[model samples]
Target: MQRHSARPLAALATIGTLVLTGCGTESANAGAEAASSTGAGRTIHAQKFMRLTQVHDETGMTLLEGPTFGKDGGLFVVDVTAPEGEPKVMRVNVGKKTLRAVHTDGRGTYTSAQFSPYDGRLYLSDFSHGEIVSLAPGGGDKRTFFSGEVDGAQMNPDDIAFDEAGNLYVSDTRGLSENEAHGRVVRISRDGTKATVLAKDLAAPNGISFDLNDRGLWFSELTEDRISYLRLDGEGKVTSRHTAIRVDGGIAQTDSIAVDADGNLYQGLHGRPAMAVYDRHGERLATVELPSRTEGLESATNVAITPGGTKAYMTVSGPDGGYLYTFDALAEGIRQSNGG
Candidate 1:
């Protein structure tokens, strides 16, 4: 890990969950509105917007992630550990600070969500079930969108991205292998009649986003501790790929990511309530941190920004509980910021 400061840091997320860490406090600022200054950057802190979930009275843990916004400006989020029968896909009334589950037949482990540009329906990546499911904007009409046995094996779909044509791009994490190069980026045609593995044999492809003009995609491989950009051809096939950003090993894994109008990437870190910003060309911009690393609020797993604006929100969870934080984005928000 490249530490700009020599100061020691501390905790959230533990040894026994999807996040694999523990947290306790609830204060942290993640991103800020883009500044015109070209001098040394300052730390950006996040403000706690709401307490999304309480600590599991029994498990002492909760994982809050997958923050995405709908067309109507409704904020949607998911709980990775919410039991089978509970409402896992929830919509947060940002104005009222209340939450309601839109998708509630609940039987799958939904990790990430994004609304399809073509149909305006919300699409979620069911990690445990190895499927991609879609539901109506109001949470009705749940439908199994994709269930392909790619390479003759079930996919562990982690994050999702949709192109202008509505084709789905998914990150198949390969079931948590540290060094195994079995991960893949799968592309499911918009018609739901075909599935193609765009890229394979990856370390662990997690967060993903489409590039401007639908030319390609940028994604993070948590196991390798780096982010790469995959340039796609006219048909959304990878024609060339290159690493954009590479960071030293850190205890915290890279979770979901977002992109801004300028193409800057806001990469969320799993173990802390913070975010790392990188320019479109891969220059490290800044690290948005909590003003005070309050206990139990360290899991800044995923983030979402308002379309075409700088307003943003981050989803967090830990030993203390789950929360949503708001902050200014580094640049004007784009569609990529509201997706998986």
Candidate 2:
């Protein structure tokens, strides 16, 4: 692993279930099945915007998650070094479109990493270690925040996010069996004092995010091929659950998601070559064409959006190399309410 300054850090499917069940699948209808509307959202098509930037994962077995922006304006990413490769965190300057090593702790195989608006630190998920680790910027301060041994079953930490009040949430795609790999979302405190399971029994939970107002928690079930939502409580506990998007096809599990300022949701598809955009009302807004076939583009896993709602970033796990790609975002538009 490439160590840097102050380095410390860090789906299931059937036919429908089989396709979208786990991470990747060998489905004949994968492409066609992913090209339509799901859930309550209206399906819309998007024009090619901009191919802003592309990054190459120089080392590591797989670039698992991220492109998560930092307060200092750079992005944090994790490389899951498989089969005895030391995991690493890389910093990318979005403005300069350059990459640099931030931390190299040989910290097992890490799947994803995210910046917490509350703590100003980075939370990283180690899939092999089954734990969520925290790393100080530039690899300064580091420690394990939460371990992923839920109900005595091993967990594959996939994604993490935070709510308005700074509460941390993580997705654990446990595995296959009903109780075995059903998947669940866990919540951690800003101070790392409390760790709680917010929701359980989800099928291969992957990317997670909160609504614009932070009133609800949204998660993706890769195996079930559905995006689910849960109503949060005063104490940050998830109360009610519902489906946001349920695709009817081979398999269309989502890997990552981003939300616009206008309350729209954008999801990155794992197998197919595109991203799904949803309006606030759970209406399918747009399906943007991603660079899917060019090697790793087919496994476009994670996504991040600028706070200003202008541009979006996606990680392309290409064959020869993994890359970070940028796209122009259409913040939000209002068609004239003709008959209102």
Candidate 3:
């Protein structure tokens, strides 16, 4: 009886193995070949780059949006939502790989935060609070710096950057339901007293960075798959506008941007799960691969570079509690252009 039972089990296992092999073949056949670059009416296969290597995975659950460096060289990230449970600013000691809650505003969804070198204050844009709030220089008391309806308008202020003269720039981006093209870039004065529109009709402008020369501004439009530039006066006013780099045959959703010491612009291509480095002249130098394929593109929102300018840092969004990734720049084949 025992031999009879063992023989039947062995036969059943063999049948299951055959079924699995058939399924594997079918799955492989379902995927078409990846598109190839065309050359003189011929197809040239393009190799996919290596996926992003992990840097620091979060132990907690805070949804990190913008990761900026503090004056003390600490990495500060704006937690749009508190980790698994608590509500607060997600502060990471990169040197130690430890996480802490710096501040809890009760109002959640604080998307992007930056430290102002001019006054040593922390300027943050609250996506949920619907205002721009700042911390006392060196991280003390927190208060609303700019709030109460943008240009008497309602919108989501997602990211912000500052100019040399101590002026504040905020990305007042609108939601999907609204179709009035209310997205805008607003400049706030040093005193936090005056705010004015520098450019309008921007489609989901998410990240803003100053060029190396401090003569112009580069910002990303999430809905448009295009990086753009605006000429600015010493006082931070728009003189001209033009598209800098268009993501060819891909979505233009970008969340954060950072520049290396040499002035190359590195942008986080959110939903595409890639990082695109552009020469100062707006040409794409490389596209670094990311780990996950499901990120919303708008979620991998911020990029930061170490002072040494060798390694770059980026954050992933949501349920993943976001991750900090370090990138090694492959600068050999990349050309240095102008405009940074």
Best by TM-score: 1
Model 1, position 166, has a per-residue lDDT of: 93
Q: Which candidate order results from sorting by lDDT in descending order?
A: 1, 2, 3
lDDT of each: 0.74, 0.59, 0.57
TM-score for candidate 3, residues paired by index: 0.74
Top-lDDT structure, candidate number = 1
Error of 3 at 318 (Å): 4.7
- TM-score for each predicted model, relative to the true structure: 0.86, 0.75, 0.74
Runs of candidate 3 exceeding 4 Å displacement: 1-62, 83-87, 249-252, 291-299, 330-340
How much is 192 displaced in model 2, in angstroms? 2.6
> How does model 2 score by TM-score?
0.75
Error (Å) of candidate 3 at residue 130 is 2.8
Worst 10 residues of 3 by lDDT: 331-340
Error of 3 at 23 (Å): 26
Task: Put down candidate 2 lDDT per residue, 80-135, tens digits, no spaces.
Answer: 54222233677777777677777766434566777666676777776656777878
Q: Which wins on TM-score, candidate 1 or candidate 2?
A: 1
lDDT of 1 by residue, 1-340 (tens): 1111211011111112332221223334433436536532446777778887765433345667678888778999987666544567889989888888776553566778988888989898877668899989878788999886987978888889999889999988874534568888999998777899888888778889986567889888877778888999989888999888885426666767788888878887766677887888777777666656376565577889888877789887666667887777777777888747
Each candidate: RMSD: 5.6, 9.7, 14.3
* Angstrom error at residue 173, model 1: 0.3
- Across residues 1-340, which tens digit of lDDT does each residue of candidate 3 receive? 0111121111211221222222001211122234335311111111221122111222222345666777576667655544224534656677777776666644545667777657778878766456778876445588777776667765477778777666778776664234345678788887777888888888777777777777887887776767888899876878899998775525436666766656677776554445666777876666554433434222345666655534445665434334665555532111111101
